[model samples]
Target: MDCRVVVEAAVPVYDVSTADEAVRIAISKTGEMLNPDLNYVEISMGSRDCPHCDDELEPAFIAADEGLVALELEMTVFNVERDEHAARIARKEIGKRLKNIPLEVLEIEVLEEEDEEEAEAADEPTETEPDGGSGDEDDVLPEFEELIDE
Candidate 1:
């Protein structure tokens, strides 16, 4: 499948060397007002209720620029498996965590799967198969991934 998950959300960032520092600064910025502790975010894609294994579709792989001290003014998660329900939950949780920061969301675009094998599978359609027998449903590296990794 040729699917990708795209997310965009504004965040307040500060100059920090690592993700740890970035997290601290980000949290603090959002906490400058009332109920600050309520808006502490660890990662844009992570779940507020559960930190571990609770991200918006786990990243199969990742490589940051890691060039210098910096905090994220905005964060995005992309090229993940598309699920409307999950996306909704993830975004809502994130919004709550970043409530103090006041984010300006631009867009969340997803490149859903295109059944490459459809052209072939049609010739062998099942009598009553679920989702066309998952033909061409396997995840593949998104095209943009190559550009970023390069």
Candidate 2:
């Protein structure tokens, strides 16, 4: 089974003046840490809301030239036996990259059969002609043959 895991990370950024700047710097730092190996992971700002009024809240908090930004890192874990297993794998993989950063498993969604099929179909290459002609090798233009002959 495949599971889509969303992990919340509290990333620390320094020398930031605004919440937006903190968030941006945090994201860039996180990306730099997880590149080349886990490049498929999607990183985005974490969602926060006021408990009483349910109003949207800023994902970053700044204090004295230091900031802690809330960010969500999502990745799909494939061929797992259970949801818990997938979550553990995701946490371990992400934790190794973002050392010392606090992480919490926010959500784990099991990929449906239809979703898997759709993903597979999208990955499969489609055969098509670039010039809107029939995809047949015998249909090559004679001008192209002249170039090859030369």
What are the clash counts of all predictions, listed in order? 1, 0
Off by over 4 Å in 2: 115-150
CA error at residue 41 for candidate 2, angstroms: 0.6
What TM-score fits each model? 0.26, 0.77
What is the C-alpha local distance difference test score of candidate 1?
0.42
lDDT of 1 at 112: 40
TM-score of 2: 0.77
lDDT of each candidate versus the true structure: 0.42, 0.93
The pairs that clash in candidate 1 are 5-80
The sequence of per-residue lDDT tens digits that candidate 2 reaches over residues 85-136 is 9999999999999999999999999988797799787666566645544556
Q: Which candidate is the best by lDDT?
A: 2
Q: Write the per-residue lDDT of candidate 1 for residues 1-150, one digit (tens) a residue.
A: 122233343344544455555455544554443144434333333212236855543211122522111222232344445455445544565566556443433344444434545766675658665556545444344665666998
